[model samples]
Target: MFDISGREWIEEEYLRLHEQGLVQEKDVVKVIGVHNQMCERCLNQSDEWFGTFTYKEQLITYCRQCLDFKMVDNCHYLYRSLMPAKITDNAHVLNIDFKLSSLQQRASDFAKEILEANDLGLIWAVCDASV
Candidate 1:
């Protein structure tokens, strides 16, 4: 039986983690359950172990086996990866063993040719499409 205050505190921490790239965006989505009123990943196996979080005067169910996910009754749930992004020791090097696919290589080659030729229209890569 958790209180609403505890939920708010945890959510604030989650938001902070999201800002620091330790979690997904602060907006976690609820995956509607189909059959079981349990965590989609863990699917509570009647272990009789769990935690509760109060949301709007209702207790949101959380599984003990898997904590990163939560369920609201059997129909709704919110999920976020608890695992944080990996940080390499060398910030300059991203991946040591990385291979590009044939199609990707061709596209890269085409872009390189265009850049080398000083083309007026250069293909731009959009990394973050937050809008």
Candidate 2:
């Protein structure tokens, strides 16, 4: 079977995978609830970005932030495969010919720390408009 871990799909996609025998019913996991005040996919917490609609006599809530990519809402389920027991660690090397400034070096070091811990971190750097 193909590796589906670290991937998220919709209900229809999961059903297709099941029909293809790539994924079993027990292997699928629903990650979030419908009518969620916050969007689990995009982490959009703004209430104004969410909308409700009637479907089959049921009110369904959806996240607009990620709607362009896929319909993320209560009526549809976000499916994910179960994580593997052991994950292999690979060395991630940063290849830069030029030396980084002190500020950039600090950000790079911080990113490495968070990545080693398997946590989320964002390093925002604004380049000059002229560049």
Candidate 3:
């Protein structure tokens, strides 16, 4: 079972992406599923979400609440997690023929638009452009 808030976030992200012309309606369901799976895997892989952090180190592995409050402070991780492996694989295979820079720029623009429309406080630093 998926957390309600997590599920809602995934749906919202998918819709935002669609609205930005980054992804199509047909891809929404697949993207949402992948996002949910990735988030669940990330949570399971990190013990910090449920355990305590030592005070000696300022580094604290935040819980789900903390992470949510941070609004996915790391956009690179979020982008990588949200992007389908197949797209990356295809890009690699077509590297010689495709304009990687142009594609990345478009993706960046799309991401920025989505973030702006949603009023997402965190910027996607990994993007080529800022919203």
Candidate 4:
């Protein structure tokens, strides 16, 4: 089996991997729960956004919010790896032509610090140039 941990895939991609023997049904993590009628992938539970259609003589519920990206439905499944993806400390290079404002610089610094420390944090920066 190929290493496909820590990632979610739609049904078509999952089936391709399964056909290559890189993944299996048992290894898939379903992205939606039938009992709850909620899409685990997008966490959408709005009844208005969900609809059913007949496919192969079976009715299938699908999430309209995530449909543009990929079809997430009741009869089908979203697949994720059972194992965690490997983490690396590889340095990432950023290439940008524009300079950041003072506020943006501070926010960027804070974000970098949190990532380097492997800590969880949120930075909110609001800008109103017209003000």
Candidate 5:
């Protein structure tokens, strides 16, 4: 089951991977065990080793570079760190739906634009889809 945000869910998966030896403890980069506490990306960046906790299930390890950008508002990495409930009032039900809708619309619009563009080729098409 998922918590308020998708990040927690990913953390849980990381922990499982750690326990299974699919990921080492050193693979995690940052951990903010506290609920709603802001993360310190600079401090987090100093650490080279990380492992997700089986109980907490969030990234517990990160290098300085990754951590430095973790808290940036427009960063895609930061978006990954966001907990669903933290971003929305009704995470499990309402907020996720809203976010998905927004993402789908963006994807649809981008696809349409790509299709309409004459100069873009296969490689560019794949990159566009990733965005």
Candidate 6:
């Protein structure tokens, strides 16, 4: 189950992955709730790794051994991922010379025209449907 779920501090995150067909369902029951988390700063800090905390009127869980780092609260969300394709690790180029698709080219041309005019530019699209 650990092999399938990978390593996540939250159990429901793995279950959520299973529901999304990202992980095997058989591994869900075998997954145990993670009651401890290594400090993001120092994993081998101490046995008293995790402790409950409070900040901004919200209760949170944090790494006690490292001055309370890597905190998570009620509003926090966790995502456990399966094996995913690796894209470019560091591709932070602002602009590149590449052949764009027709639709993308249209958007690019529109953006160029707007920028050339030096007016308030607005080019909106469904950036992400999931969110």
Give per-residue CA lDDT, model 3, range 30-101, as digits (tens): 321223223322443344343334555543332353354333321112322233434343443333564557
Give, for candidate 4, the lowest lDDT window spanning 10 residues.
Answer: 122-131
Q: Write the per-residue lDDT of candidate 4 for residues 32-74, one digit (tens) a residue.
A: 4322778766778899988888988998888886676677888
Which stretches of model 4 miss by more than 4 angstroms? 1-3, 24-27, 31-35, 85-131
> What would the per-residue lDDT of candidate 1 be over residues 1-131, giving only the tens digit for each residue?
21122121134455565577655544344344312545454455464745567878876566665443433234353444333344457633446475766655665688778767976333344443222
Better of 5 and 6 by lDDT: 6
Clash count, predicted structure 1: 0
Clashes of 6: 0
TM-score comparison, 5 vs 6, better candidate: 6
Question: Against the hidden true structure, what lDDT does model 5 obtain?
Answer: 0.37
Off by more than 4 A, model 6: 1-9, 25-37, 40-49, 52-85, 96-131
Q: In lDDT terms, how accurate is model 2?
A: 0.75
TM-score of each candidate?
Answer: 0.27, 0.62, 0.26, 0.56, 0.24, 0.28
On TM-score, the candidate that comes out on top is 2
What does candidate 6's lDDT look like per residue over 4-113, in tens digits? 43444344555566677756644333322223444333343355655665678875665554333344333343333444334455632357676666776777789878
Residue 93 in candidate 3, Cα distance off native in Å: 12
Candidate 5: stretches off by over 4 Å: 1-10, 33-131
